[model samples]
Target: MRTQIAIVGGGPAGLLLSQLLNRVGISTVVLERKSRDYVLSRIRAGVLEWGTVELLRTAGVGERMDHEGMPHDGCYLAHDGRMFRVDFRDACGRQVMVYGQTEMTRDLYAAQDAMGATIIHDAEEVALHELDGEAPFVTWTHDGKPFRLDCDFVAGCDGFHGVSRPSIPKEVRREFEKVYPFGWLGVLSHTPPLADELIYASHERGFALASMRNPNLSRYYIQVPLTDHVEDWSDDAFWQELKRRLPEEVAERLVTGPSIEKSIAPLRSFVSEPMRWGKLFLCGDAAHIVPPTGAKGLNLAVSDVHYLAEALKLFYSSGDGSALDGYSEQALSRVWKAMRFSWWMTTLMHRFTEHNAYERRMQDTELAFLECSAAAQAVMAENYTGLPY
Candidate 1:
């Protein structure tokens, strides 16, 4: 098989890239190691930066999102048994959209299918060849049959554990990572949200986040030890712990119900520098990862896709390879900013076991400063709403 670009993952990053490029008459093929059902079944964060919301609209998959997704001007921060709101619009003249990653992926898939775009699911043992040469190709197996796809370029949107990142020779790739000592015990419930907007709580016990996917669906999380397991907490136990961490007033109005989904996700900040190597370009989790505190994982990937898609479009249209040559530097600049923001948020909200009393007081003082200072709030709003593309 032959295509202009071979996308090595069918997740939102790859599908959105394909959607954007296809609209401009570029050809792409997406390969996935799992079935379509498996991809859509995975639950993920819903908060969308204003820029990400706009990009989805540009990709022609935002109709459903704009119709069903919740748009919030700002979110709440809880500390010392009290909560304060940061008005993103008032401070930065922007807002974020609350739309689940699963829903966006579904929309992308629907758009891709309607356009007859190529997406091959259940592709195993995917490998890249000649990535440093003029000719690049991808190979994988399906039903015990070998297949090869020749393409002008390869997009490594296959995520952190996928083959794309490892394909880059260790001698050329540089990686930086920080694994947090804690994880988030998240639950999805069929109930109304505790508040109109998301609330991030920093309590004496731990960190908690009150979020929602829609009016009837609420998502909540509480910080937990890394050694904890999903089976360790029952639905009642989870809700009880969450309520303890939330503000008394906010917890009073909280509605509890059977959890539809539950899981524990460890926090981490990772980045593999130089997102591009020869004909291969990395996007999303394949290039960088941020803790969920800043809601940057999916949004960061979308930004990478935006850069690579535009670069490829320019290369094909104007015969200008300069943008392609600069893709890594351009994306990394924004990636590092997001990394800093996520790290800062994670440090501020979580109760780190390693932090001494002085360090804890510092965290408390920082949040207190952000609560009262307009300048600090504006900075938070700007970073939370997202930096410019």
Candidate 2:
């Protein structure tokens, strides 16, 4: 098989890239290790930066999102038994869309199918060859048969654990990472959300976030020890812990229900530098990862796709490879800023066991300052709504 670009992941990043490129008459083939059902079954973050929302519209997959997704002007921060709102529009003249990653991926798949784009699911043992040479190709197996795909370039959107990142030689790739000591115990419930917008709470016990996918589906999380398991907490216990961390007033109106999905996710900030090597370019989790506190994971991936797709488009149209050469620098500049923001937010909201009393006081003071100072709030709003592309 032959294609202009071989995308080594069928997630949102790869599919969106294919969607954008296909619209401009570029050919792409997406390779996925899992079945389509498995990909769509995974639950993920719901908040979308305004830039991401616009990009989806540009890719022709935003119709459903704009129709069903919630748009919020701001979110709340809870501390010391009280909560304060940060008006994104008032501070930054922008807003974020509350749309689940799963739903967005589904929309992208539908669009891809309608356009007859190539997406091969359940591809096994995918490998890249001659990535540093003029000719690059990918190989994988399916149904006891070997296959090879020759392409001009490869997109490593296969995520953190995928083969794309590891394909880069160790000597050429530099990585930075910080693994948090705690994890988030998240629950998805079939009930109305606690509030109109998301609420991030920092309490004496731990951290909690009250979020929603839609009016009838609520998503909530509470910080937990890394050693904790999903089976450790019952639905009632999870709600009680969440209520304790939230502000009294907000918790009063909370609607409790049976949890449909539950899991524990450890927090981490990871980045593999030089997102491009020869004909291979990394995108999304394959290149960088941010703690979820800033809601930047899926949004960050979209930005990477934007950079890569445009670079490829420019190269093909104008015969100018400059954008392709500069893809890493441009994407990394924004990636680092998001890394800092997510790290700062995680530190501010999470209760670290290693922190002393003085450090805890500083966290409280920082949140307090952010609540009262317009300048600080503006900075938060700018970062939260997303830094420019």
Best-fitting candidate, measured by lDDT?
2
Q: List the residue pairs that clash in candidate 2.
A: none
Give per-residue lDDT, candidate 1, residue 165: 88
lDDT per residue as tens, model 1, 103-201: 999999999999999999999989999999998999999999999999999999999999998888999999999999999999999999999999999
- C-alpha RMSD in Å of predicted model 1 compared with the true structure: 0.6
TM agreement with the true structure for every prediction: 0.99, 0.99
In model 2, the Cα lDDT at residue 133 comes to 99
- Give me the displacement of residue 272 in model 2, in angstroms: 0.3
Q: What lDDT does each candidate get?
A: 0.96, 0.97
Which ranges of candidate 2 are over 4 A from the true structure? none
Regions of model 1 farther than 4 Å from truth = none
Query: Considering summed lDDT, which 10 consecutive residues are worst modelled in model 1?
Result: 160-169
Q: Score candidate 1 by TM-score against the native.
A: 0.99
